[model samples]
Target: MTVIDLVAQADGADPLETEPLYHAIDPDLLDSLPDADGFSRLEFSYQGYTVSVTDGTDGVEISLAETGVSVDGSSGDLIDTEFST
Candidate 1:
């Protein structure tokens, strides 16, 4: 949900109006993944961008592929919040 929300935010679209998340990945499998020691991570494409979910350590994180700018799911704050022209 956090992942979808942030991507929608970046795209200036409503979360509900954006592409369905399940079309890119399985929500159940995502939820079932372990979050121990920050080793568990999942990367998939959604809404034309690569979405990465990293659990544990610093909580859930979602980033735009290799953009370096990432959203911290727990805080809803952008990390490395910069964009190149």
Candidate 2:
């Protein structure tokens, strides 16, 4: 499945005690991400609600407060957490 699809499915769940599903993707491939910049505005299903990753100058960030599943970016890291739904 595509990254978006995987993220959407994972996000649609209860936030309480939900463990963040980590998906490590190649950074090189991320450079070709189609909606990289637009992802911030796109909401995905998270904890029975729609949430979006906020794209910052450095990179993308996703946080499920209750679940403690925070996804962040790293510079030049070979393996990076792509999404947490």
Candidate 3:
């Protein structure tokens, strides 16, 4: 999935109806992904989710607001911690 599709899934909205990706990253940033030489990655928060795009990958990853939960998981905190410091 493209970054835009992941953002749409994260927001529970239509891809076209969601905020344009241009609002989050420069349009050219995406255009350059195809020519990555090494481990190129882009990260940004949009529509309440943390988005991660890695070069040479066909999928876009989305996580919930960086609150210790992944979008596709249906469980408690994935990180085990009793204290927040």
TM-score against native, each model: 0.63, 0.28, 0.55
TM-score of 2: 0.28
Best-fitting candidate, scored by TM-score: 1
Q: After TM-score superposition, what is the CA distance of residue 14 in candidate 1 from its true location, in Å?
A: 0.7
Q: What is the lDDT of residue 67 in candidate 3?
A: 39
lDDT of 3: 0.55
Q: Residue 24 CA error for candidate 2 (Å)?
A: 18
RMSD of each: 9.3, 13.3, 9.1
Residue-pair clashes, model 2 = 2
Query: lDDT per residue, candidate 2, 1-85, as tens digits?
Result: 2333544545563444343433233434443444554554444444332344466666654432223333442223232324553
Candidate 3 stretches greater than 4 Å from native: 56-85
Report the error of model 1 at residue 5, Å.
Answer: 0.2
Per-residue lDDT for 3 in model 2?
39
lDDT of each residue in 2-85, candidate 3, tens digit only: 666655665568888877777777868666666756646676755445555655345433333443544455444534222110
Q: Give per-residue lDDT, candidate 2, residue 75.
A: 29
lDDT digits (tens) for residues 1-85 of candidate 1? 7767777777788898977778888877666665444456777866556677666455655666434333332323334431211
Q: Backbone clashes in each candidate structure, one number apiece?
A: 0, 2, 0
Q: Which candidate is the best by lDDT?
A: 1
